[model samples]
Target: MFAVHRSNGLRFLRSGTRTAAFQVRHSSTFAVWNPPKQAPREVPTPLVLCSASHWDSGTRNNIPQIFATMLAEKGHTCIEVDFGLPGDGEMCSSSQDLMDRLSEELKVNLHLSGSPFPPVIFARGFASLIAQAYISSHPAQGLFLISPPPSNTSLFPSILPTPLGEFDYELKFPVAVMACPTEMVQLRKHSRLGQDELVDLIEIDNLEGRDAFLRIEQWLDELGI
Candidate 1:
């Protein structure tokens, strides 16, 4: 059963499978119940940055902090989740667990915080798969890949046991891939991703020894994000 009060001084009532309408009139001073207005939706905070390090390196190597600092300077919140290792044993299991948590956190925070802001995953080397797999299942607003190696490369072959051909599944959002000139050449030959799949393809002159964080910042500016 349901009842609705109409503005024309009428009350509509529905009982079981029957509907009835009645008019309720009173003096001009008679008070009437009014539905409360819904609160406005809140704007979400800045992106939650997920930073992953190389396969063999530890998170304490300062790489995550460096990137976080760079983003922080631009008024973005960056969170680092360290997968720690690349092998198929403890590190792999731990990384998979972290991915699950990230998905859960994004869901919970978005609802409880009353914000729709989505996160962006930034990964390098072997930990890139952790980001990719998480995004594949949970989906994010954006993805940023830096110097990602081929799925079968020596550095992190086991990181993505699946062949590149199998990654034909469409992603839910935009991706930005930044690779060194050398790495870009290799990626074009072996990677399943193409320019069309990415929002932008950035080529860096030197990635092995140089800091190309500024390029990422510039790209973000271009996006007006």
Candidate 2:
């Protein structure tokens, strides 16, 4: 049993047995209600925008898919897109053009959801370069790059478009990297890799199964996402 009284732009709630005061602030379109002793529920995980080598289902592998699947299992809404470079005869300009398209898609999705929070971008291999480019203008909660392609390897030589140091990456928000020890070493050659500006480097080989999930969750926790 409770009673609510409204007067002078304020609402007061009084329980029959126990009287408790509540403050309600009214606005043009909504009201802000603050209740006491409300139990916290599970919050929907921050949306994750994932990208890999290509968009086609047939050409795709299971690597980036695994990340999206795992993130979904952890309660995140993961959207996977293909920002990979076209393999000749493709109409798209590949990198920049794909990122612009992705940015537009993200804006549309966020608007439709009506959520003020922005989604984090997750990229694997060469697609990380695209993610880095997108986050420069459009703000995001975070950026996670897994196993970004090495600069000079047995398969490709001088393949990286722009060096990591040259990329216009925003250091305001957190940026995480999950790569092999050798890959991290390779990245250090191009970028001034260190533990600053909310940048974290995790040795992917060190994380396995539940441990990997926990590490990412911990990062989100620290960021208050």
Candidate 3:
């Protein structure tokens, strides 16, 4: 059993290294993920981290927003982190350096949330790559990768490091991969980690709409997270 919240209060954080924003959303209110941290308070939701494709790109559908809301409604603090990749204006010398910066900021936020260590993180695409890089060395409650990229994509070497070739996340904690029909094959072909035992692969025709949520929710139920 975890801290289950049925409250309507939701808080989202969109943060950068030096700049941070906060927003608290109640029913019928529009909220931005990267709002200034001075919003009116309500019942606090449990805190969890979620990373999505840059700028809500339609390439992966709107699963990012859906995932955030689903967790928020259940009393989890659904923080939507807008992280940047190597060429996405994230001025870092290498992937490891970027991960270190993010890791530091995450630890600080974890302390502020009063949540347990090794948080459950949901990440997608390039964000998923970064998430894996973080979890490889850190302990985590769970890892959910949405539409993950293969380890050996033609473009990966430009952004990722060599040591991540093995990935080996399954040895650290529970891992899951949620992919649409389009991305599922490549995941199995190039990224063997998406295998049944190593990682739970929930294949969907499309990673949008209500059906996608139900499948992902079912997996969470199975994991008891």
TM of each candidate vs. truth: 0.57, 0.60, 0.67
Give the per-residue lDDT digits (tens) of candidate 3, residues 47-138: 24445344235465445556665554443455555453333355767555766666555444455555454567777776676567677776
Can you write out model 1's per-residue Cα lDDT over 1-225, one digit (the tens) per residue?
243342435444444323333332211111111111231221123443334433435423344445654455445545444433222332324434544544444344334323355666666655455567666766566777776665434443364333332334475576777786888887777676634555577887754333577776676666565
How far residue 106's Cα lies from its native spot in candidate 3, in Å, is 3.2
Q: Which candidate order results from sorting by lDDT in descending order? A: 3, 2, 1
lDDT of 2 by residue, 17-76 (tens): 222232222201111112223323323444544444343234344454455445554445
For candidate 3, the per-residue lDDT at 192 reads 66
Clashing pairs in 2: none
The residue ranges of model 2 lying beyond 4 angstroms of the native Cα positions read: 1-41, 55-64, 84-102, 105-114, 150-165, 192-198, 206-208
Clashes per model (N, Cα, C within 3 A): 0, 0, 4
Error of 3 at 181 (Å): 1.9
Most lDDT-accurate candidate: 3
TM-score of 3: 0.67
- All candidates' lDDT scores? 0.49, 0.51, 0.56
Candidate 1 off by > 4 Å: 1-54, 58-61, 85-116, 152-166, 194-199, 208-211
Candidate that would win on TM-score: 3
Among all windows of 10 consecutive residues in model 3, the one with the lowest summed lDDT is 23-32
